[model samples]
Target chain A: MGAEHTHGLHLPGQSTVHRLPAHLKIVSTLAFVLLVVATPREATWPYAVHLAALMLVARTARVPAAYLATRLVVEVPFVVFAVVLPFVATGPRISVLGLSVSEPGLVAAWALLAKGTLGVLAALLLAATTEPRDLLTGLTRLRLPRQLVEIMGFMVRYVEVVTGDLRRMSIALASRGFDARSPRQWPVLATCLGALFVRSYERGERVHLAMLSRGYAGSLPVLDAAPLRVGDLVVAAALPTMAAVGMGAAVLTR
Target chain B: MHVPDGFLDLPTSLATAAVAASAVALSLRGARRELDDRAAPLAGLVATFVFAAQMINFPVAAGTSGHLIGGALAAVLVGPWTATLCLTVVLLVQGLLFADGGLSALGTNITLMGVVGVWTGYAVFRLALAVLPRRIGSVPLAAGIGGFASVPMAALTFAGLFMVGGTAPLDAGSLVAAMASVHTLIGVGEGVLTALVVGSVVAVRPDLVHGARRIRAASIQAAAPAPSSGHRA
Candidate 1:
């Protein structure tokens, strides 16, 4: 097993959704998720509307349903959480298949699943449409600290390198007849990790030297990307604007 | 242990976001002072290393297995400030690309894992090292103390936050107890592995271990030009 996998999250397209500035998409995504988080669990209709609106964006962006299915695997823990809620919750008991479950717990479980799923889909959609570099570019213009953003950029670049080193080390261990079938073998693994750290740190020192030789003067070249336009703002605002409306109607009606 | 979106209420989530944002701000300043020109690429590689390290799995029982959490380990390898940044970067990338934790929940995850975990682990490492002999051998034991405490502290903090803003009406006390006890076991694994890694590194290259710095300075007559310093002028 290696650290290799398809790192390509940004689905390239000529659609307007793909053309929208990264910063605006980031703002819109955050705004949408915030609205979902704020809505009361009883306001279930808003959540359905949120999903419908998300599906519309996904359609426009041409996000593959299969890719999203893989992305939503993050929901498994929440599902397990929802499963236990009914049993642990205290409320009026309702019998189903000869087993009593709390009524309040059932409602709570539905609330968690609905809100959690909507929030995740909204984020995944953002990832699907935006290039990772543009996402960082968006973060930079949003006034995230320059140094932190720079570090994040490096992480994006070098994650594969370090993980590949790890895979090779693990393979080396296996080839030497070391089987990590139990925790007793973790010390050997830990030793390997120690070695890996030394290698990574040395590589970092070499990179520092490389940067210095290239005249890195304590900062990266300033990123001056202001790609958003008035029309793009309206396009970006559409999702959150609808989310805000859904939130208002949810509050008033529910 | 990434908390999903719906678990925490908005007010609680916002509060944590503010807290995480401030801590990151502080860390950016601290890391600049610590790493300076090297902050960008160096911290990036450290973040990548932590990401890679967390993937290593160790079997616990007949079937169960667990992976490294790396906060305490990172604190020992680098300082707490850089370690905090490393974790934030890892968590942010994971959230943006994989949706591993919901964006709305990012603040809470950063607070629990980065700020609370690194600070507590670093503090415990310092305190544990203080009581032991002033030698590199004591480094790993101190790291173990840090690793042991960091996990439960983060878990305890999460339990506290849940009590304040949990969406569900689950009993707060039970949640706290469960979170603390389960993490204590995980912390045991964390502490042991931390000790092992730290010990191994100290044996060969004490200078690489941040927590072993005092001992390295005391034991060596000169900066010794660390055989692996990569030619610092």
Candidate 2:
């Protein structure tokens, strides 16, 4: 389990944002995103303010803007959908560079692009600063159900192993001249997935037996018992509080 | 099917979030019954396996490809309640860690993919299993039917959500038609994947499959001597 998979998006740093407790950072990120979502889409200034604030946090956390921008590729599909909206959306049409586009569609596109980008950036920043295990621990600390947290822990632990199994199976398939080019070849792919499932299920049983041999009852032991500090709460609240203030201002100026 | 933030109105997002949360709560209770000490870890592995399996995309059409949503697959391998929980965990991880889905729209994603996908797929799977032959051979076909229907069902659910709270003013009929048509193609890919996987598992270890448990038990009973005929007063 100590494989190279633990460092998911986490960039090691001693920055203030990175030093903050995981639960605090998680809450802060959630609150910030909620504020971003809650902001009126028509208020362009609020979005600008939100972006600036996120940038400030990124700077403090030492996460490169380029790194954040590169990860935005995940939103490419949504971006494509947003780009198409202006053409297909109904309602008041306006001429843009000789081609008529829907006015409401333009607004919808902007809202999706701006809000979606901010949300992704916020989540990326959280992942960048916090270790994957710490995030799970944070959830546990935040009083998420113990069973759910345990399952998530197992998921994070075994994802790489299962992925390795999938890769090996795919290689085996390819070695046998399987190209999966058309829908007709889906049966082979499905068989691969099936084999993977059986392998994983058997591995699961072995893991359970191993746990039982180690005197494992139902729950895993909690290792991190550190309590939250008051200072951490203040630092965590700063971003969301600023966001709230910015949103209020955006509404007022509107 | 990952709806970004601001695509729907706040009220609708919140409402869906509430529904998603309750569904998860119900799943938690239901999963407890299914996930004994032996199956709990397997349930977790099922989620992880689904996550990895979802990464593998298969071509569905000339220019398009789709991956397994794994609702029916998971519901068949594990139980439906645990399947919902597995999907929710995967979606949670994807949204929070990978930034693949929106935090604000997490509710919508979970509701559409996890709840609707699992329930619809499981319902169809059960229906297929009932109508089809009650044997190990039929498990995969039932699962395939379930998986095939689930994608479009989830798409329809998303279209419905969009109709209620879509930011862009679009014709509902066209939206549903477009979503259904495109997703129907995706559904074919889903069906093939689900069938192959379920069929393989049924071939190797039919006892491990939740959906095929009845078949396994019935086969066992048939193999054993009939107690009613053997026993005497």
Candidate 3:
């Protein structure tokens, strides 16, 4: 989704949302998700408020609404899970559109659907705004620990290479009359994965030897600074505050 | 089996996050000792490989598809501690950039997929190696079983969390049975890949494998004694 959206959906807009610190964006996104999750399902009004606030942020961020929606298609499976919830959940029954549904189940379904969709959008907006490298740097600065961060930096860098390897292996298998759809062809599929793994392990060995030849101590050198400016705090505070209000209102009314 | 955010309740999410964070803390200390400059970059590449491996979903059954969790495979290829860090990186990247998982649910994903997946799988793989007859084939066989078992173990952990914290009224039996059934099938793919990979690497460079580290050392020692006996006679 990130790759596709980067090329087609992400618009180059001159907006404050785009300029906000990546760490702040990450922090606030978490805060907002907590607020949404804390909000009770019994209270629909608060959720409505939360949704409205998200739209305002989207507008502020200058993310194309269509693009946001397209990116959000990743949440489609959860929607399926939600659609089935009413049928499976045992609760008081009600009728909607001349069909029987569980009352509590409907609420549960709504809760899952709304919160899941909003959470995914929060992420999409973050990605649509920040570059992948900047996000890794931000995570590193967020005190996520150096070992993890360095690994993430390299993982992001080499994902394309590893994926290319998988593609090549799959093509090789296909050329050798390996039809994956047949149940009898499990051995061929297994061999493809086996070959891929051996190649990957060898690659890991060579990469290790290469890194060692360079002056790599236990940790990667920390060079860039991730300063949390006052502006970042201000931007980070806004969404959470709104989310808190949304949750409080849900609790009070319920 | 990435569980998206909000599928789990707050308590479950928070608890899992705490566990994940602590495990990461421990792993960081361990990695500092295990990773010299050379291994660190390779660990990064392995993580990237896991990420790409995940994207290539091998078909499981008629229409269902599953991706590589790569926890056990990573642990077997790299050390377990390094593998934990690698899997953590993969999860973070997937969560933040790809939006494949919920940002809020990052801890839960890491705990189940990274820590539990790597440790449990690696432990089982090691145990199998210990109990089995010392043979090169057994190394991959044990790794295969370990990789297969780890997926359902992760699923079981999720089931436990949901049983406690889930707002949905799913019965424990139905949920576990459903999750186990699907994951057991997924495990087959995991085992095959892990065994084949670990086996091949052992064939080429056994010294590089952390799980096979002891086994390789033992084999080398045994071979050295035989050659020396021939020279002495």
Q: DockQ of all candidates, in order?
A: 0.64, 0.60, 0.48
Angstrom error of the Cα, residue B198, model 2: value is 0.6
Maximum-TM-score candidate: 2
Best by DockQ: 1
**Model 2 residue A117 CA deviation in Å:** 0.6
As a whole number from 0 to 100, the lDDT of residue A50 in candidate 3 is 83
Worst 10 residues of 2 chain A by lDDT: A1-10
Each prediction's Cα lDDT score? 0.86, 0.86, 0.77
Error of 3 at A164 (Å): 2.3
| CAPRI docking class of candidate 1 | medium
**DockQ-derived CAPRI band for the predicted complex in model 2:** medium
lDDT of 3 at A59: 91
Tens digit of lDDT per residue, candidate 3, span A109-198? 888888888888877777778877767667877888776787777777666666667778878878887667633555555555555656
Candidate 2 clashing pairs, residues 3+ apart or interchain: none
